[model samples]
Target chain A: MSPRSDTPSSPSIDESRRGLDLGSDRRFLAALILLGGTYVSLLLAMVAADLFYTTPGHLWHALGSPEIRYAIRLSLLSCTLTTLLSLWVAVPIGYLMARFEFPGRAFLDALLDIPIVLPPLVIGLSLLILFQTAPLRALETVFPVTYAVPSVILAQFMVACAFAVRTLRTTFAQINPRQEQVAMTLGCNRAQAFWRVVLPAARPGILTAATLAWARALGEFGPILVFSGATRMKTEVLPTTVFLELSVGRLEAAVAVSLLMMGSAVVALLLVRTWSGTGLAGVSSLRNG
Target chain B: MISLRHITIQAGSFNLRDLSMEIPTGSHTALMGRTGSGKTTLLEGICGLRSIRSGSIWIGDREVTNLPPGQRGIGLVPQDGALFDHLTVRQHLEFALEVRGWALERRETRSQELAEWLGLTSLMDRLPAGMSGGERQRVALGRALAFHPPVLCLDEPLSALDDQTRGEIVAVLTEIRNRTGITILHITHNRSEAERLADRILHLRDGRLES
Candidate 1:
């Protein structure tokens, strides 16, 4: 008898046994089918139509109205303000989380994430309560904050800031802190190092956060309605106009406003893509190097 | 002169304890050790990047123990030539000069001189990521040296290059030192490169200087 064989004779079987899972073809096929069936572009189109379509005549009338122009301007202005403010707040917070050792840092990080997970409506309600109640209410009386333009801004600021902080913290974490230290050793003081090295290096990531915050603020409805009461011409934004039109059964006006909102979202995305291309390319290369 | 007295640095688990050493002005010292030796830690301590738990450090007459890195007047070319990939070769040198408050005229002149000296005149406009390992290392060295630092620290400067490229860099480094007379603290695990460049050698193991 031949010596008892220990190794399999078929090289294909042995090679396949090394790195291949043998029984997941069906599951893999199922995943691909599910992915194809739930493709995102189709879903976006369906949701966009449902959210935006009302009556064509009202839609056209709303588009031509001067009030719509004011709404658009105010919406863009407020969202821009919210984005800039969010970035201003997020950078230091993100860098601290990335590069420092401190007390209660983990707790603070967890707390920052809470707003992102909570419904925007809930956050709005909570802010309203805090501003209306005692202690906080007393503080607010010294600085009033409910159902005003500032309230709308405040609500946008809160949610936008939360999104920015979370995104930026992750961005900063992905960078090596050694780069800043190296910059310092090259005779740059802390601020100089941050400006010259850290900020430039973190630009792409920061831009990403800003883009997200701005878009989120632009599309915000739940928070603004609850906090600022959706007053016409004072705190009414694009989303609120759509909401108002829908509630009043002005179907075409609602659709038109929705289309405008959708158009702006597209424009925002395009601007982000174009603006971040070169900066992110440089950053990604540096990261790889 | 760079001096460390009773320096100790604590990370999560490894502790570099009571490490005392000195690199005199205009003197080249090579730090040689096995893996895990505190050679890089000592360099960072000298540069004031890592905090010293218990020690006094002086770069020349300035007490740099607690000072920030920029105030220490030190330049470090880290391992694998950690050049900013987004910056061009000329920009790398200019950045150092700019940070040190060099005048515009002096910045241009110094960058030109360094680029020519490093054989980087042909590649000044190219970004670091597009450069070869040797080219990147050369740019990094130039960036560090452009500030005219009294002392320069290098960590495994030639370890990432091929044999031919390593030879070329060693030649350039030797020429740069001969002309500038800048003090060099070179850290490497390679005995051969250390022997080629070092005027004096410090053999360290587990954060302690070995005889």
Candidate 2:
């Protein structure tokens, strides 16, 4: 007799085949998780080392130094102001881009990201040329100073607003306007539905936009240096302070400022990660669909 | 009562032409149509989400054809439930109540009552994302009925659920209708769903209401 073939439809065989396939793909998944974890660990290590090496006494002494204090105060004030102003403008622009179908929308959206890709020095130089000129200089003179504090704000504002608008627009785009329409059918007018339905939905995106804009404004240096000279106590923000100390061979001072900025950034990152429920909600909504 | 006459709307390539139907007061009416049979477009036209070229929509004693969606007291539960993903189930109910300017205590009580009625008491603290499809539909239904509009419209509410969940939701919806006596216009492609839930059935084909 010919050799008999025993081909049983065993469930165990099917499961083992699936198990092998899964085992084969596990390496790629492990590599991705490991890479991400390593990147985060490196960031944490850098931050901890900088902050720890600078003793409290050193930081306390630096805090008393009028130049450092001025830089800290100015950075905080300007970044806060820039974040508020950018949000006021970005929210509406972002909402319009997300909700409406209009001419040049794609081009408008692309234009918003230009600042992110464009060099900060170039942005600073462009503003310097634009506002430091005859007609624009005349406009600038209405304020006490142009090439110092205000210029820093203006440059920071320009870049921060660009990021804010782009991030918010993406967030709003993720939300469906159908929710608002449904709210309307349930006896809500436009304003009512917007506040009760749409705004709440878009809050996470708005918050993310705020955080990113604040971070960008805080780290701003090249633009501030080019447009607003790095005059200590006048236009010197944190990053510029770091650069000035480094150039003067005051490595300890530079490290201290770096640590401060790092702490601020870490706090911002934690806040974003912890309270980004809206972002999480939007992501889940997309996944559900 | 709500009535539509000769409603025509074109969105991109999809066209609904000469559609007409009537939803009587205090009756649950079902609109059965295949996908792209203009079921949603027709519903949107009535709610003013879509502008119609030629049509008359009357709600109660008023002609609301040209009124904005908010001005028409028509409650709509979309396929997605359209619940604000950021809001808690309780907040979703209160959002409508607050918009209608209901007193705070009343709004709170009403939300509580609705949460209990829909068996959503345990899930009241959760967002739409945390809920199952059936749970979300119940929440959306509760939100729509919170303020008690003159008429309610449900667009394929059960189409997204599994068979077991679909049966459970249909029973819940039926209970709601029986309790409130609110007129409902439910649009669905599933004939079995229509048979199980509707008091009357109207079919749509090529944008026209068929006998």
What are the candidates' individual DockQ scores? 0.44, 0.52
Best prediction by TM-score: 1
Predicted model with the maximum DockQ: 2
Candidate 2 clash pair list? none
| Candidate 2 CAPRI grade | medium
- Tens digit of per-residue lDDT, candidate 1, span B103-170: 99999999999999998999989987667888888888888888888888888888878899999989
Tens digits of per-residue lDDT, candidate 1, A1-289, equal: 1111111122222235544354758688677667987887687887667555555666667878876777888888889999999999999888777667677877998999888899999989998888877787787777766877778778998998988888777666655565667788888877887788778777777888898889889988888999989788888889988888778887777778877777778887876676556454554544444
Off by over 4 Å in 1: A1-30, A39-59, A134-144, A270-280, B60-62
Q: State which docking tier applies to candidate 1.
A: acceptable
Query: Tens-digit lDDT track for model 2 on A28-103?
Result: 8688768998999998898778877788887778788899999999999999889999999999888787777677
Tell me how far the alpha carbon of residue A115 in candidate 2 is from the true structure, in angstroms, after superposition.
1.2
Distance (Å) between predicted and true CA of A35, model 2? 8.0
lDDT of every model, 2 decimals = 0.79, 0.82
